[model samples]
Target: MERKKLTLLQTVFTAGVFSAVSFWYGFMFGRESARKELGGLIEDLRRGTAGSEPTPRSS
Candidate 1:
Protein backbone atom coordinates (compact mmCIF):
# COMPACT_ATOMS: atom_id res chain seq x y z
CA MET A 1 0.00 0.00 0.00
CA GLU A 2 2.77 2.42 0.95
CA ARG A 3 4.70 1.66 -2.23
CA LYS A 4 1.62 2.29 -4.32
CA LYS A 5 1.06 5.65 -2.66
CA LEU A 6 4.69 6.64 -3.26
CA THR A 7 4.44 5.72 -6.92
CA LEU A 8 1.29 7.80 -7.34
CA LEU A 9 2.92 10.83 -5.72
CA GLN A 10 5.98 10.53 -7.95
CA THR A 11 3.85 10.31 -11.07
CA VAL A 12 1.90 13.43 -10.09
CA PHE A 13 5.08 15.40 -9.38
CA THR A 14 6.66 14.34 -12.66
CA ALA A 15 3.59 15.32 -14.64
CA GLY A 16 3.42 18.75 -12.99
CA VAL A 17 7.10 19.45 -13.69
CA PHE A 18 6.77 18.32 -17.30
CA SER A 19 3.75 20.53 -17.88
CA ALA A 20 5.50 23.61 -16.43
CA VAL A 21 8.58 23.05 -18.59
CA SER A 22 6.48 22.54 -21.74
CA PHE A 23 4.49 25.73 -21.11
CA TRP A 24 7.66 27.75 -20.52
CA TYR A 25 9.30 26.37 -23.65
CA GLY A 26 6.30 27.26 -25.78
CA PHE A 27 6.02 30.78 -24.32
CA MET A 28 9.72 31.43 -24.86
CA PHE A 29 9.68 30.37 -28.51
CA GLY A 30 6.24 31.53 -29.62
CA ARG A 31 6.31 35.16 -30.82
CA GLU A 32 2.84 36.34 -31.76
CA SER A 33 3.77 39.22 -34.07
CA ALA A 34 6.45 37.26 -35.88
CA ARG A 35 4.09 34.36 -36.41
CA LYS A 36 1.42 36.71 -37.69
CA GLU A 37 3.88 38.36 -40.08
CA LEU A 38 5.07 35.02 -41.40
CA GLY A 39 1.49 33.95 -41.97
CA GLY A 40 0.79 37.16 -43.88
CA LEU A 41 3.88 36.69 -46.03
CA ILE A 42 2.84 33.17 -46.86
CA GLU A 43 -0.62 34.34 -47.82
CA ASP A 44 0.84 37.04 -50.05
CA LEU A 45 3.12 34.56 -51.76
CA ARG A 46 0.17 32.27 -52.40
CA ARG A 47 -1.73 35.19 -53.93
CA GLY A 48 1.26 36.06 -56.22
CA THR A 49 1.79 39.34 -54.43
CA ALA A 50 5.30 39.44 -53.03
CA GLY A 51 5.92 43.10 -52.20
CA SER A 52 3.63 45.68 -53.79
CA GLU A 53 0.34 46.79 -52.27
CA PRO A 54 -2.89 45.63 -53.86
CA THR A 55 -4.70 48.30 -55.86
CA PRO A 56 -8.45 48.49 -56.15
CA ARG A 57 -9.90 47.01 -59.36
CA SER A 58 -12.88 48.79 -60.83
CA SER A 59 -15.25 47.02 -63.20
Candidate 2:
Protein backbone atom coordinates (compact mmCIF):
# COMPACT_ATOMS: atom_id res chain seq x y z
CA MET A 1 0.00 0.00 0.00
CA GLU A 2 0.98 3.59 -0.55
CA ARG A 3 0.64 4.36 3.16
CA LYS A 4 3.18 1.71 4.13
CA LYS A 5 5.69 3.06 1.63
CA LEU A 6 5.21 6.58 2.96
CA THR A 7 5.74 5.40 6.51
CA LEU A 8 8.95 3.64 5.61
CA LEU A 9 10.26 6.68 3.77
CA GLN A 10 9.49 8.91 6.72
CA THR A 11 11.30 6.62 9.12
CA VAL A 12 14.41 6.50 6.95
CA PHE A 13 14.48 10.28 6.56
CA THR A 14 14.15 10.86 10.28
CA ALA A 15 16.99 8.47 11.05
CA GLY A 16 19.26 10.10 8.52
CA VAL A 17 18.54 13.55 9.89
CA PHE A 18 19.16 12.47 13.46
CA SER A 19 22.49 10.91 12.52
CA ALA A 20 23.71 14.04 10.73
CA VAL A 21 22.70 16.29 13.58
CA SER A 22 24.39 14.07 16.14
CA PHE A 23 27.62 14.07 14.16
CA TRP A 24 27.54 17.85 13.79
CA TYR A 25 26.95 18.43 17.51
CA GLY A 26 29.75 16.07 18.50
CA PHE A 27 32.23 17.81 16.24
CA MET A 28 31.14 21.19 17.56
CA PHE A 29 31.70 20.17 21.16
CA GLY A 30 35.13 18.75 20.39
CA ARG A 31 36.28 21.93 18.71
CA GLU A 32 35.04 24.01 21.63
CA SER A 33 37.00 21.87 24.08
CA ALA A 34 40.14 22.10 22.00
CA ARG A 35 39.81 25.85 21.78
CA LYS A 36 39.54 26.19 25.52
CA GLU A 37 42.59 23.99 26.09
CA LEU A 38 44.70 25.91 23.63
CA GLY A 39 43.63 29.21 25.07
CA GLY A 40 44.62 28.14 28.55
CA LEU A 41 48.02 26.93 27.36
CA ILE A 42 48.72 30.22 25.61
CA GLU A 43 47.79 32.19 28.69
CA ASP A 44 50.05 30.06 30.85
CA LEU A 45 52.96 30.55 28.49
CA ARG A 46 52.45 34.29 28.45
CA ARG A 47 52.42 34.40 32.23
CA GLY A 48 55.57 32.33 32.43
CA THR A 49 57.39 34.56 29.97
CA ALA A 50 56.35 37.68 31.83
CA GLY A 51 57.48 36.25 35.09
CA SER A 52 60.97 35.47 33.76
CA GLU A 53 61.58 38.95 32.37
CA PRO A 54 63.62 41.68 34.00
CA THR A 55 61.99 44.94 35.00
CA PRO A 56 63.86 48.26 34.98
CA ARG A 57 63.82 51.20 32.60
CA SER A 58 64.53 53.98 35.07
CA SER A 59 67.07 56.63 34.12
Candidate 3:
Protein backbone atom coordinates (compact mmCIF):
# COMPACT_ATOMS: atom_id res chain seq x y z
CA MET A 1 0.00 0.00 0.00
CA GLU A 2 0.97 3.62 -0.37
CA ARG A 3 0.94 4.08 3.38
CA LYS A 4 3.37 1.22 3.85
CA LYS A 5 5.68 2.72 1.19
CA LEU A 6 5.55 6.10 2.86
CA THR A 7 6.39 4.56 6.24
CA LEU A 8 9.31 2.72 4.76
CA LEU A 9 10.58 5.89 3.11
CA GLN A 10 10.31 7.79 6.36
CA THR A 11 12.19 5.07 8.21
CA VAL A 12 14.97 5.13 5.63
CA PHE A 13 15.18 8.89 5.79
CA THR A 14 15.40 8.86 9.54
CA ALA A 15 18.16 6.25 9.46
CA GLY A 16 20.11 8.22 6.86
CA VAL A 17 19.85 11.38 8.91
CA PHE A 18 21.03 9.64 12.05
CA SER A 19 23.94 8.08 10.21
CA ALA A 20 25.02 11.38 8.72
CA VAL A 21 24.82 13.19 12.02
CA SER A 22 26.84 10.51 13.82
CA PHE A 23 29.47 10.54 11.07
CA TRP A 24 29.73 14.33 11.09
CA TYR A 25 30.07 14.50 14.86
CA GLY A 26 32.67 11.74 14.95
CA PHE A 27 34.68 13.40 12.19
CA MET A 28 34.50 16.75 13.91
CA PHE A 29 35.46 15.72 17.47
CA GLY A 30 37.26 12.42 17.00
CA ARG A 31 40.83 13.53 16.14
CA GLU A 32 43.67 13.95 18.60
CA SER A 33 45.36 16.86 16.89
CA ALA A 34 41.97 18.42 16.27
CA ARG A 35 41.47 18.48 20.03
CA LYS A 36 45.10 19.05 21.01
CA GLU A 37 48.09 21.05 19.83
CA LEU A 38 50.75 19.31 17.69
CA GLY A 39 53.54 20.40 19.99
CA GLY A 40 55.31 23.51 21.25
CA LEU A 41 53.32 26.53 22.48
CA ILE A 42 51.27 24.00 24.45
CA GLU A 43 52.97 25.03 27.65
CA ASP A 44 52.10 28.61 26.88
CA LEU A 45 48.43 27.83 26.34
CA ARG A 46 47.79 25.18 29.08
CA ARG A 47 44.10 25.10 28.17
CA GLY A 48 44.13 21.27 27.70
CA THR A 49 41.25 20.71 25.29
CA ALA A 50 37.51 21.20 25.67
CA GLY A 51 35.37 19.99 28.64
CA SER A 52 38.49 19.54 30.75
CA GLU A 53 38.25 20.03 34.46
CA PRO A 54 40.87 21.91 36.44
CA THR A 55 42.85 20.26 39.21
CA PRO A 56 41.66 20.90 42.71
CA ARG A 57 43.73 23.43 44.60
CA SER A 58 44.76 22.56 48.15
CA SER A 59 44.88 25.04 50.95
Candidate 4:
Protein backbone atom coordinates (compact mmCIF):
# COMPACT_ATOMS: atom_id res chain seq x y z
CA MET A 1 0.00 0.00 0.00
CA GLU A 2 2.79 2.43 0.86
CA ARG A 3 4.66 1.81 -2.37
CA LYS A 4 1.56 2.24 -4.46
CA LYS A 5 0.73 5.57 -2.82
CA LEU A 6 4.25 6.88 -3.43
CA THR A 7 4.10 5.88 -7.09
CA LEU A 8 0.76 7.63 -7.57
CA LEU A 9 2.07 10.80 -5.95
CA GLN A 10 5.14 10.81 -8.16
CA THR A 11 3.05 10.35 -11.29
CA VAL A 12 0.77 13.27 -10.41
CA PHE A 13 3.76 15.52 -9.67
CA THR A 14 5.37 14.70 -13.00
CA ALA A 15 2.17 15.40 -14.92
CA GLY A 16 1.74 18.77 -13.19
CA VAL A 17 5.27 19.79 -14.03
CA PHE A 18 4.86 18.81 -17.64
CA SER A 19 1.62 20.82 -17.92
CA ALA A 20 3.23 23.92 -16.41
CA VAL A 21 6.20 23.76 -18.77
CA SER A 22 3.99 23.33 -21.83
CA PHE A 23 1.85 26.29 -20.80
CA TRP A 24 4.91 28.49 -20.43
CA TYR A 25 6.18 27.50 -23.86
CA GLY A 26 2.81 28.21 -25.50
CA PHE A 27 2.57 31.63 -23.81
CA MET A 28 6.03 32.62 -24.99
CA PHE A 29 5.34 31.54 -28.56
CA GLY A 30 2.03 33.50 -28.67
CA ARG A 31 3.73 36.64 -27.31
CA GLU A 32 6.51 36.43 -29.90
CA SER A 33 3.99 35.99 -32.72
CA ALA A 34 2.00 39.03 -31.60
CA ARG A 35 5.17 41.11 -31.35
CA LYS A 36 6.12 40.25 -34.91
CA GLU A 37 2.64 41.08 -36.23
CA LEU A 38 2.63 44.41 -34.39
CA GLY A 39 6.02 45.27 -35.85
CA GLY A 40 4.70 44.73 -39.36
CA LEU A 41 1.66 46.94 -38.71
CA ILE A 42 3.89 49.69 -37.35
CA GLU A 43 6.10 49.52 -40.40
CA ASP A 44 3.08 49.77 -42.70
CA LEU A 45 1.77 52.86 -40.86
CA ARG A 46 5.16 54.50 -41.12
CA ARG A 47 5.21 53.90 -44.86
CA GLY A 48 1.74 55.53 -45.28
CA THR A 49 0.18 52.33 -46.63
CA ALA A 50 -1.55 50.81 -43.64
CA GLY A 51 -4.52 49.48 -45.62
CA SER A 52 -6.00 49.17 -49.08
CA GLU A 53 -8.14 52.32 -48.73
CA PRO A 54 -6.36 55.43 -49.98
CA THR A 55 -5.84 58.41 -47.74
CA PRO A 56 -8.06 61.37 -48.62
CA ARG A 57 -6.35 64.49 -49.94
CA SER A 58 -7.24 67.78 -48.21
CA SER A 59 -6.97 70.99 -50.27
lDDT values, one for every candidate? 0.80, 0.80, 0.66, 0.84
lDDT of 2 by residue, 1-59 (tens): 99999999999999999999999999999998888777766776887854555543322
Question: Rank by TM-score, descending?
Answer: 4, 2, 3, 1
Candidate with maximal TM-score: 4
**Please, what is the TM-score per model?**
0.54, 0.71, 0.56, 0.84
Query: Across residues 8-58, which tens digit of lDDT does each residue of candidate 1 receive?
Result: 999999999999999988886777656766777787799999878954432
Query: 2 or 4: which has the higher lDDT?
Result: 4
Measured with C-alpha atoms, the lDDT of residue 33 in candidate 4 is: 82
**Which whole-number lDDT from 0 to 100 does residue 32 have in model 1?**
62
lDDT of 3: 0.66
Query: Which lDDT value does model 1 have at 20?
Result: 100
Query: Could you tally the backbone clashes for each prediction?
Result: 0, 0, 0, 0
**Which candidate model has the greater TM-score, 1 or 2?**
2
Over the full model, what C-alpha lDDT does candidate 2 score relative to the true structure? 0.80
Worst 10 residues of 2 by lDDT: 50-59
Best first by lDDT, ranked: 4, 1, 2, 3
